[model samples]
Target: MKKENNTNKKAVCIMSGGMDSTLSAYMMKNQGYEVIAVHFNYDQRTQAKELACFENICESLHVKQKYILDLDFFKQLGASALTDTNIEVPTGGVEEGVPVTYVPFRNGIFLSMAAAIAEKEGAEVISIGVVEEDSSGYPDCREEYIQAMQKAINLGTKDDTKIEIKMPLVHLKKSQIVQEALHLDVPLELTWSCYKNEDKACGVCDSCRLRLNGFKKAGVNDPIPYA
Candidate 1:
């Protein structure tokens, strides 16, 4: 996302209340953009926790405008473990190829909704925290795929409405993400990344493992609790 000297520019940030997205929102704020926060409740396993975290993070960011959209359809069309109870969230580790945790075109759906919101709000950009280099193998997180989505979004929207989809963490490793978040003073404790167990993060889940590994690599202790 481009830094602006004026605060008139707006960004609709797709925040999942995770470390990466929280950091992205802060980066936008630091760049002098008025942020409009958006969170999706897709009936994922950790929906409640994520929502709570989103609210807290938004408060801390002093975000006045926000949207908490409920997307229950993701539960109905569940193939991924995050939205489907039938499928178990893998505790082993991140796997090669697309994992079961990769909701079919999840980011695409999110970006589509965000685009509509951005056009409605007259925002110039939409920010998301999709890490491709060091992340669970989700096809939609790829930078190439996101660039394609940006093109598709621009083509689909009104002629005058031009919105850029920005993924700041797309190429960053988890360790780098942690370092950046720390530098930005993002409230890491307010973020949740576990795919299972909302109360105490299941430390063995792919999300938890990745988060822990990031903190380890950064030589910082993770503030969130794990079980």
Candidate 2:
């Protein structure tokens, strides 16, 4: 959708309807970018809830252009707990090394899709909320990895089409994310981080635990309900 009359800078934000990604979208909007929200339904365990949250967050952000893509191949791959029901999501704690919940090159695929969308939409930026410090030890969340992906994306696209992959939350801890989200007035309550439940957040899940810990450390109560 070409906004012939609009002159604002634009970004294609990869939102997962989770706290981090939702905050990223809001941050882009706050930076005066016309946010183009991109969400993927990768056959994850809580796809419906995540989609609902994505829609609600989009409404909050007043995002006009959104791409809700379906990648069913993730379920066929069946490696991560979020995609395969056979592998149980580890709720014990955020263990060392990569967690079972780490989807296989999920961000890479998402960025590739976002790059295509950005190129098509004439957007100059692609934003993602990948936390490195205090994260669940996912290797793909590293800043270097995202930088390399940015290089690859630029190389693959048209020569004149330059794109910047912005990961503002890459180095931030969850507590910092909470604080920034609050400062930006992000609709955190509309975000979903539960890896298992849809109706109410399973507070014991790794995702939920991180979110809860962030809120606790920030001294702000999470508006979302937990089980």
Candidate 3:
């Protein structure tokens, strides 16, 4: 959707309705970019809840432009516990090595699609919230991978089209995320970080544990209820 007369610098933000992503989008908006939110529903276990949170978070952020892409192909190509029902979601404490919940090349796919959207929207930047220290061992969350993806994206696009991939929360710990979100007045309550059991968030899941621990470490109450 092209506006007849628009002069604002634009940013395509990949928001997952989680604290980190919400904070990242807020940071983009604070930097004077007209924020365009992009959310993906890849048939994850908590897809419905995540979608609901995404809507609410977008509304709270006053985001006028939003895209919800359904990558149903991810479900069909499922191998991870998040996309495949056969692989059980681990509930024990965070384990070493790559987590079973890691979606295969999910970020690569997302950034590729986002690059196309950025090219169309004339956006200069694409922002995603990927935490390293606080997350389970997910290979795709590393900054090096994102940096390489950014280089590839710029290289593959037209010479005139330059898009910067921004990961505002990449190096931050979960507690730092919580603190920053509070400072930015982000609607953290509307965010969902649970990997499974979306009705009230399975608090034992890796994602939930990280979120909860962040809030606890920040010495703040998590407004969202947990099961």
Where is model 2 more than 4 Å wrong at Cα? 1-6
Clash tally for model 2 = 0
Model 2 TM-score, 2 decimals: 0.96
Give the better candidate number (2 or 3) by TM-score: 2
- Residue-level lDDT of model 3, residues 64-131, one tens digit each, is 99999999989999989999999999999887899889999998999999999999999999999988
What global local distance difference test value does model 3 have? 0.90
| TM-scores for the candidates | 0.97, 0.96, 0.95
> Which residue pairs in candidate 2 have backbone atoms (N, alpha carbon, C) closer than 3 angstroms, thus clashing?
none
Point out the worst 10-residue segment of candidate 3 by lDDT.
Answer: 1-10
Candidate 3 global TM-score: 0.95
Q: The CA-based lDDT of model 1 is what?
A: 0.93
Ranking by TM-score: 1, 2, 3
Q: Taking the candidates one at a time, how many backbone clashes does each contain?
A: 0, 0, 0
Candidates' RMSD to native: 1.8, 3.2, 3.7
Per-residue alpha-carbon lDDT of model 2 for 1-227, expressed as tens digits? 11234467899999999999988887887777899999999999999999999999999888899999999999999899999999999989877788899999999999999999999999999999999987888888999999999999999999999999999999898999999999888888899999999999999989999999999999999999988
Query: Candidate 1: misplaced stretches above 4 Å?
Result: 1-4
